[model samples]
Target: MIRLSMMMGRTAAWVACLVLGLGAAVQAGTVDVYSNNVGGDAVVGASPTVAIGSSGWYYSDVRVGGTAGIDSTFARSGNGSVLFQGDASAGSYKADVSYSTGESLGKLSDLSSFSYDWYRSAASTNNGIQAPSLRLLLGVDGVYKGALVFEPYYSLTTPGDVATDTWVHSNIFDPNMYLWSNKDLPFQEQFNHDIAFWKSEIGNYDILGVSSGIGSGWYGTSIAAVDNIHFGFGEGPGTTYNFEVGAVPEPASVVSFLIAGGFGLAGAAYRRRRAR
Candidate 1:
């Protein structure tokens, strides 16, 4: 009887450890920066529009004309993703969307990493490889400092090019990953540089927010979507955003759900072990 009791205690402890381990595996760094389910359908642009979405996020079709909004037809995670469609047949158009983070996003030199998942529809007719560009809004002393841009066309890393109808994860912060600052310059003159180089060149810079979309020259009515954005600052775990359609559980609620599930699993494990 003593040996059986000891075995049961050990089993329970092991089960508890397993549950805790599972919880630890869940990404604590991830944050739902923008989880609202607004603008699920495409909004055709008659003229350039700004601040087109709820929250601080805004959509712009400044280049030519196209559509921009949250889309439900395809998503990398959850039930939706921000979609951009550039018009080509009529004229060159770009679909750009941006989010103005209410708070200062820290300095450029402190930015440790930036990544996002993007999808290019097979129907898109951009250069066989062009998808979308990740733009980081920059400022200094509360003054605008144009955007720091990263486009797959200039990337030297593997999976550096866009593949239509498939979601591709792009980590622009990787060393040697090419990027350019479009401040006071034309796209042709904005030469590509690595993150380290940009940091030095930009001097004192503050990250204003993040923007991603398709266009400028992505002609042929190309379509693309972006989601799962992450920005790491100064060696920290960083912030992550998972765009979703419709209401999502608050962070606390999600934590409670996970804890409850873990406890339930532990109970089941305990019972099975005792039955033995």
Candidate 2:
């Protein structure tokens, strides 16, 4: 019939363009940004693709000299960046129960947004700056417990302040989620604790942490810079692709859901041959 259905719709459009050109040369969720200036000093797992062995990051504070290296004089795009000395410590029991900017990023998957690129450097005295609230921390099944409690920017005025040309972007998932509370709004004005016990145990947490929680700590030696750090986003907005964050659709996101259901069933069989 009709030339055998136009040779079976051109052999299923050449097998969906050869499986979307081998799924764009086998690309799959891979993101890690320590600014790559090469973790020179700041010990404690001195990065190696960031996380594979040496515990990517950890520093609960009290001024252990608040460190974390690699910062070739500030970068917002690349080449180098991620120097967060912010010294200002206090650990007697809560000036920073300790958290030199906690990091572990292992098994990271689910993310629609987590951007980064915050630089503040009027040079020193900005100390171990953090207090503006910033905790994402998770570990679901592995159990580091969960947390969202946000706020990294509201800027009474100068967003990301200081200056190095102000590299502030920090999104961290829309309007800053939030789920740590005495009822919320920052559990009795700032962190009394009990955040609904990990937002009712949300799972699939492939380990991650990004604290600043339990405020009023560090803010003296100043100098922050972090860089282009990104996590997947987009299976929508102008679409590029995104799915990572397992517990389900693995296998290259099931070949991106069978290449988006074979182009949505070839656009519904070419609109049923223009409605006959």
Candidate 3:
């Protein structure tokens, strides 16, 4: 009976060690991009600029024929308004907000997954016509690297079109179907394009740029407004780090697990000897 009790104690100790080791191994990281707080406010400038609104939201502006190269007008009902407006020209423009190396919530070194919530509004005339949709780009260092273009199936018609607001989540690691079309083109072609873009554009950069106004032909005498831009990393589709747990296992955990396993085996052997 004494031998059995000793064996049981040994077994329990081994199991406890294993559990503790595994628990230690569990580590995680997170990256959150929001309009109101953090350093995510907006890149400051005239026309093609960003700022925080009285409502505590970030606004971006795109202007026409401005030094900022943005041909859009940005406005807001509150203290902050980043405008993207122009005088009925048809071209493409880009704007960006960058998070420095360690500013992100989780200090995500690698962009794993990304998601955002945005609201869109148009100057009441282009209801039936298709206006250019906003495209999201991820940059590294200071270069225009990779892009995640989202084309809304819906059209912008009126100002303050609250219905157009929605949350979009995507994995950076997965294939972006919205950017590539699969018809007669082979699947590999799309993959290659993405690879090239990511490698050249986002491979080692830390900045994230939000670009709008692509394609040609603009609806006459109208404007578009976007607000509440949010980017979340580590929890979404392609986010690298695991926000729920941590991105990778700590070194200590691996060592602990091995030690625990050794203890368990040793305890088992001791029990067998005692039984004999």
Candidate 4:
């Protein structure tokens, strides 16, 4: 009887460890957030086209000629990517897609990771390696605050530092590695101000949304695509917006899959214990 009780206690401890491990694993991995290709076709619109997901990502072209949409031709990984294109002929053309949903909004210090894959076409009439840029919009409610912008043109490497005609993966999570503009002044590009700086300066401001695209007098006839927008904030699991060309699994489907996997893992662990 004593030996059986000891074995039961050990098994309970092992099961507890397994459960904790599973929880950690779930929190660590990236879950699918949103997609561009919906209902087997590419969609584009001016000033707010919804990407298919519960996450509520939307594409917008603030200017008349600028446009943002799903492009099947220039994908970074999957069969599709979000494309931003505009000509300087239109006044300050700016096109972008943004996520203003709950998963994105939070205090500045709560951001743990932020990154995206961007592409610049060689055919871009822009003089240098012009590409789509990334932005973190800061504000509260519906009010407008300044944004933190990231552009590859600031790099001292090449015509733009980033290679054209191919996808460039950027890791902007580290404030030390990437330069960001406060966008307080027109075309005001500066660096070294990290998230901590923003927190100190504008303690009341919070992250309103995230955006990626090109234009606003960037150059003439620019073309770019963005994909795999991965980010984590507000104590939630990380999410990757895989802009793809096919049907993506629903959130419910993902949850069911995780639950099934957990059961399988637990069963395997139980069998191992029995063998022991």
Per-residue lDDT of model 1, residues 121-212, tens digit only: 88876687687788888887767868888877677446554577888888876766777777652243454677777788774688888888
Indicate the worst ten consecutive residues by lDDT in candidate 3. 239-248
Stretches of candidate 3 exceeding 4 Å from the true structure: 1-61, 65-86, 89-113, 117-123, 126-134, 139-142, 154-177, 180-207, 211-219, 235-276
Cα lDDT of model 4 by residue, 232-275, tens digit: 77666677777766666654565566556655666676668678
Q: State the lDDT at 162 in candidate 4.
A: 63
TM-score order, best first, reads 1, 4, 3, 2
Q: What CA RMSD would candidate 2 show? A: 17.3
Can you list the residue pairs that collide in candidate 4?
none
Residue-level lDDT tens digits of model 3 in 36-142: 43222323234444432222122344333211111123322222222333333433333333222322233224444443323234442444333334444444344
Question: Tell me, what's the RMSD of every candidate?
Answer: 7.5, 17.3, 15.0, 7.7
Model number with the top TM-score: 1
Predictions in order: lDDT: 0.70, 0.42, 0.37, 0.67
Candidates in order, TM-scores: namely 0.71, 0.26, 0.35, 0.68
Better of 1 and 2 by lDDT: 1
TM-score of 4: 0.68
Residue pairs with backbone overlap in model 1: 37-246
